[model samples]
Target: MGKLSNCLSMIQILMARPKVKIDDLAAELGVKPRMIRVYRDELEKAGIYIESVRGVNGGYSLDRRSILPIRNFNSTEVQELQIAIKSYLSKQPDHDSTLDNALEKIKAAQRDQALSSKHFYFANDYLINAEVGNESEHYKRLYHAFNHRKKVMITYEAASTNAVTKRTIHPYAFVVYDENIYCVAYCEQKEALRTFKIIRIHDVVLVDQSFYLPENFDIRKQFPHLGFIREPQEVELIIDTPFSNQVKESIYSTDQIIEELPDNAIRFKATLNGEQSIKKWILGMGTKARVIAPEHLKKEIQLEVEQMLQNFQK
Candidate 1:
């Protein structure tokens, strides 16, 4: 190996073993013991400092944190990227050479990285950019079913009645809304398309049977309001100070508007999809939020508060 190759090899050795003897590093790289010390000096100049221990049992070790900037993709991650790219291309009628080239480049880079370095790559599921936070096993199964046009048997809990039922569903696509994960699927039990929360799904089993997705089926057209697939309502709220700032940062609806009050509060207005989800949000804000418009919603909040007081008194 050349000078640069010997330096990288020495660093790799230090990473794998804690306190590698200078003689061992030289033997591994087919270089002199003195050359190992030279490699350490070169590495230190490149901001990768090796810690040298003293006495008989002493050797050199590299801090793992310092070398973490090296970017490398594992097999699972590379495969997931390729799958996403293909999924995207499948939707487009025209052939996109750009995305195809990108996939090839990613694969080439993965192979090159594997040959150059011995990295401890984890085969974990790639997190989908959704409000679901970390990707779960349920997400992976649903994604697989969606991609393959297969049906899945899921044990689901209903948010309204807390009813649990086992049903088979043909998942259409994954939708992220209101900091949550939802799957738009055709429910076999209901014989209609329904949106389900991924978290509420307790278990998922992939079925062998495959289904065909309708070419004209568009998720956006079907669920114009997304998760809040209900009667649309024009809602208004008076949010106080710090809490108002929080509300301003997020768009509850596409047509949302905000106005600043003299007292530093905010008057928020939006054409939200339904009253149920919006009511829950107002209640969650506690004393900092109050409903201004929609008399029915205000009365409901008042009623809920009264019920809470009565329960506490009992």
Candidate 2:
């Protein structure tokens, strides 16, 4: 196995077992006992504190206190970590080079210093697939700005007003919300921290201005709503067997309650964000799903369907 795969495997083995002998680890990694010692040094540099017992029952054990929150991640969650890192690097034009450089550094930093959450994640297979497009060049520029605590000037096109405006912002961080990449920055125009979708930024340039991320600043704390777009609204959808899994796995899958209905149907209820988003999803399901509540949303869907039928007939 490659170095990184071996590192992750070593972590998994140590996490699962109480103690493992050096010979055992050497055999598991298909390397000499000398190389096992080298792996031990690498893991130690990464802040994985392995304690060696020098006795007849000698073996290696992880220091519980030295474990970062990554120790809490299972194999599935490890995959999520890969996606998160990939998305960050993909936003840069020189992604391949950036990813290689980042991985080398990641092998050394636990990232516990950068983390705000005591428990960094929850069990959800939902993967991040953000689209960066040609804006990746600017994204690359602004990405460094956030990293270095530098301010940036951006010509932004507002999604709500469709107005283009220029603003100087102190960038806190870049985050992916609802598969859309956003720069959570302190906007000088509004004098407030706001979420700006990276795609809507028409132009961006780094300013010579430097700033600090507020001691209390946290992206999750700023925007913790389950619904990814607009505001959340209550809705219930009754779906047949064929459509059940799709609704549960949807992008707006927030605060969901699923109950089995008679004759192989599922009742799925959720307080989801984005009225238009949910309408489009239900429409896509067609005969497989039906709305059970919210008369206004049902009426909106009916009108939307009517407009679609008119377009089809023309």
lDDT (0 to 1) per candidate: 0.70, 0.66
Off-target runs (Cα >4 Å) in candidate 2 are: 1-39, 46-58, 61-140, 159-163, 174-179, 224-231, 248-255
Candidate 1 global CA lDDT score: 0.70
Model 2 TM-score, all chains together = 0.61
Tens-digit lDDT string for candidate 2 (1-314)? 88778777777888899999988987998878887777778988877888899888999887765577545543323323444565554343235445546544443334443452311222121223445532366666776786677899999998879999999998775555444556778899999877777789999999998987787766655556323446567888789866675444443455778888887788988776545446755776778888888888888888988999999999
- Regions more than 4 Å wrong, model 1: 1-140, 147-150, 154-168, 176-181, 186-203, 208-218, 225-228
Clashing pairs in 2: none
Q: Which ten residues in a row have the lowest lDDT in candidate 2?
A: 118-127
**Clash pairs (backbone) in predicted model 1:** none
Error of 1 at 199 (Å): 7.0
